[model samples]
Target: MRIPQIRLESTKAQIGLKTINAVNNIKQPKADLSIEQPKAELTIRTTPSKLTIDQTQARADVDLKSVVKRMEEFSQKGYQDLLAGIARRAQQGIELMKIENGGNPIATQAKQNSQKPMKEFGLGFIPSHGSVKISYEPARVDIEVAPNKPKIHVNVNKPIMEYEPGKVEVSLKQKNELNIDFEMIDIKA
Candidate 1:
């Protein structure tokens, strides 16, 4: 009888792997878009306003204090002249009427007495005083007028405004990492 020898063996483990290759298309997309509202500033400056008004009335006053006295003097002078003319005309008319009524009485007596021419006798024929000219001057009066002026004033005011916009900030993402995994194709041969 032949005796068989016993043997023991151990095998090492093996792994099959594939490669990893890729292009990272990195684009920092317009750094987190953000916006802020606009703001406005106002400034006001002023000048003090003032106004003044003045009024004047036109007037023309008549001072009639001495008018009466002056008119009276003129009236008195006219009256005197008129009266003198009337008296003179009246006397002349009376004398002429008397002479007309008593016509040729003295001539009849002279013819009866002597038939020849008698001595000259004077008749009552008195002449007037003087040949005067009458004046007809009237009185005078006057009035005056004056004017006045008015004043005016003016004032003004103004306003101003200013506008501005807020600022914008930009930033990017901080940290990142990559990972991978592996496995065996065949086992237990």
Candidate 2:
């Protein structure tokens, strides 16, 4: 007689993995600026001075009324004395005629002298000095100023960003295998 026996074989399964990392990117931009400047303004004004002079009384000081009055009073007394002398000479002439008519030839022939008027007169004039007036005014000045301000403007831009998602994949590298075998063997006969 012979005896039979059996045999079996087995293999384990294997796995593989693939992975990708996520990525993120960010960017920022600078801002823009603008400015404007304005100029200043100014204004000025001026006025001139004034002056006045008056000479009305200066001309009246040298007029005729004051000078003539003094002269007339001084000469009138001398004129009166001259008239009286003339009258006395006329009376003496009549007396001489009478003497001649009374038959006196020597009296009629005598030389006669007419009286001369006295010159005791004064003429003087003094003028009152004229007055003066003066007036003056100073100059004046005015000034004004105006200024303008500057204008400014600014502009800003938003930030830029980029993002990417992660990915994962899994696949089999080797399959599982199983084997079974049957064998007959005789131990004793």
Deviating ranges (above 4 Å) for candidate 2? 1-8, 37-150, 182-189
Residue 101 displacement (Å), model 1 = 8.6
RMSD of 2: 15.1
For residues 5-121, write the lDDT of model 1, one tens digit per residue. Answer: 434344434443443444344433333434443443434444444443221111111223256655886799989979976885575557555766876644544454456446998
User: What is the C-alpha lDDT profile of model 2 across 105-165, one tens digit per residue?
Assistant: 4443444343344789766443444344667898788888888788888899888988898
Q: Return the TM-score for candidate 2, rounded to 2 decimals.
A: 0.36
lDDT of every predicted structure (CA atoms): 0.44, 0.70
Error of 1 at 35 (Å): 99
Question: What is model 1's C-alpha RMSD?
Answer: 25.7
Total colliding residue pairs, candidate 1: 0
Give the distance in Å from residue 150's predicted Cα in candidate 1 to where it truly belongs: 66
Shift of residue 24 alpha carbon in model 1, Å: 99
